[model samples]
Target: MPRNPATTTRDALLAAAREEFAEHGIAGARVDRIAARAGVNKERIYGHFGNKEKLFDAVIKDALDEFAAVNTVLEDDPVAYVGEAFDRYREHPDLLRLLMWEALHHRSAALPDQSWRAERCGRKVRSLAARLGEEPSPDVGRAVLSLLGLAMMPLAMPQLAELLGAKMDTPESVAAMREHVMGFARAALEGRASASG
Candidate 1:
């Protein structure tokens, strides 16, 4: 089957825009550069996304969709779940950069597409709750946040790892850290489960 030319162009634009936005963020990303990289006219961006802010939103939505496809939280082996989440973040470095840019730009302001973001977050909380064998609640949501922090904090703050002489610069070192993080996370979950039980 043939794919639509419009879809192909949109995909190209999105791929190019992802790299541009990841490197420069929304305020710094240039439509001209994105178009040039995507090998399309800048007008196509306007035609497809309406404006720069809209394009950023599209990119964000696209990134989230990508995550949902590949970053499922596991119901079994919650510890392995944490390890896998860390692996996923390592695989998608730009995602963290995009999220950091969003946080810096939005501050306390509302997200570009608040409802959609909320839904995605809600789904993750539910998934985390399932891993704990509990119904979704505020406590489970907090656990979800903690587990995600465990996964991403290392990559997000690599300077601390380097300053402390932690082993994370190499692939083998990262794999070791991933196991440590998983163990750390599982201990937390076990402590809570024991206390509650």
Candidate 2:
């Protein structure tokens, strides 16, 4: 069945809100600018989402929901899952950077409860636990968390490498880092070394 135009309008507002929040933190994102970017009036945004803060929360949650929909974490192999997750982040750099920026600035707390995050994290945990063929372990969560951090943190915070006295942006540097991180992540998650002699 055909969808209502209101749904499209809401999606547009959410997309515009994401751009505004990602470009400028929540404190700087404005309803007028978001409305102009969406090609809708500010009143529509307010009427639909209530206010700027609520809209920002909705935008972030919507992005997260879309990402969760991809469900790449279903891979049974931890290394393959890490590689695929890295690819997803590589393809959608904005989402990773936006998340990083939010975390670094502690803006997530300003939005609403973190039950959403806990839920998302819980899903990953369940998927990983099944893959490992045993009960969920803290190591599983840590492995996934560390893998994502390794793959995304540098891109999310480009200055992180410079701060650590390394150039992490170049192709060679990036490739090397990816290899190291993936290898370490595989070993860490599987709790074993490669079988090569």
- Work out the TM-score per prediction: 0.90, 0.78
lDDT of 2 by residue, 15-126 (tens): 8888888888777778899999999989999899998878877877876776675545644666656656666676777677567556655543434648768877877877
**Which lDDT tens digits does candidate 1 get at residues 105-155?**
764667777888888789877877876778989998888788888988898
Ten contiguous residues with the weakest lDDT in model 2: 188-197
For this target, which candidate reaches the highest TM-score against the unseen true structure?
1
- Candidate 2 has an lDDT of 0.72
lDDT of 1 at 34: 99
* Model 1 alpha-carbon drift over 4 Å, by segment: 107-109
Residues forming the 10-long window of minimal summed lDDT in candidate 1:
69-78
